[model samples]
Target: MDLDTGVALSRHDDHVDPFPVRRAEPAHAVPAGRMGYDLGAERLLLHTVQSAEAFESLLTTGTLRPDPELAEEAFTDAYEWIHRMMAARLPTRGEGALWFWARTRRKHLVDTCRRSRGRVLLTCRVPRERVLLSHFDEWHLVLNKGLGMPRLPGESEDDAFARWEEEHDDFDARLRAAGMRDAPVRDWPADLRTEIEKSWESIFDRGNYGPFECWQGTTHALNNDEVLEAVRII
Candidate 1:
């Protein structure tokens, strides 16, 4: 799928293998021949775009961490949830995370560069253990405070919510009736919140969503030495 255009790419009749198989030399300082043996599965080749200022910082500091100051309030909260989810579901290598497009197309990279006014395009090889992949479309549920339960056969989302509410005193339904908006997930019933967390695990399973092309990866900080290529897009 083209991340920028939302165009579907051709697929084979055979089942899709979510993991990539190509191998590469490990990042700088690793002993020769050790990578092939030590790094069992292939490392992900990912791309990300950043402003020139951020790129400069990466060069000066030798590592790039997520800048919360640059994110909007909603995104900041969403990222906090994402970080917590990552810590729980994946083996995080470092503090905080940086986002990248996993196995993305070139046109998507170019579009992202243009849209973000990004000056640097960073391509990195990261171990699978350090990354969490999620379906982009379904992520909106996390951002918008919507429940992600799968509706029962022939049931609508509203109907599912109605049935679910009956079991929980209709907490969310009452909130909606009172004209309140944006209830925090932390305020939800314990069991419901647990369900949401469980649903979030589906983000990592591309097969669960079926044929969605945009898969985002979140990983810990990346040192400049780990960056395979840093092209000036501007």
Candidate 2:
């Protein structure tokens, strides 16, 4: 199979399967230490919202690479930070990774359409091995370099910060106290940064954190052949 185009290169005959054969029911939970669905037979039906220009590019090139221009203009440094974390945690599907929602939410689609002006919803069936599923809420913590330390049930934000400060070293405490606003991860100690990066791997655990929903996935790239459907939404 062509990794870039996600299409089988060899021809057995004139006929070919339009979609991957469903080997079994989807797994209920992703196993530990395995970010991708490599161990399972399930293929995920993922959805992503992209601008009209991105859709056109997919149509023309038969593949969709990450848009650096869009990231620079809209996401600023958050995009870089998230991709960097992905590089460390999910090395195979790290570079030029494209975002998708495992479960489509109408609100997110509507908001993205409003921001991009002319956007489309792309739905595709991707082999589990080609994707990394993660919790959408915990991902923000990775981007913002926030405290990944689990909080007690009744703990307030201030209380959690205080508890985290007590558990870690002075530098770690100070950085946490400073928050990402004043002290971004760029200036953090090398060891502390690695520790934080390690913590970010938990984003793939699919467990609920706070009130945010967990429905995000990332793939290295998507090809025109893999796209099951596309709907204009602007």
Model 1 C-alpha RMSD to native: 12.7
lDDT of 1 at 80: 72
Which stretch of 10 consecutive residues in model 1 shows the poorest summed lDDT?
A: 21-30
lDDT of 1 by residue, 1-234 (tens): 445432223224553322221211222111123112111246776777767787767766777887756656756546777888778877654556788877554555555666653366676788777778877766776776555554466677699778755643454665565454365666655666676666666666655543436677887777676677564543
Q: In candidate 2, residue 72 scores what lDDT? A: 47
Give the lDDT of residue 142 in candidate 1: 72
- Deviation from native of the Cα of residue 85 in model 1, angstroms: 1.5
In candidate 2 the C-alpha lDDT for residue 90 amounts to 55
Error of 2 at 141 (Å): 1.3
Assess candidate 2 and give its lDDT: 0.60
Write model 2 residue lDDT over 90-206, tens digit each, in one string: 546535569887753455544554554346667677777677777776667665555566656777879977986775555456566656335556666667767776666666664
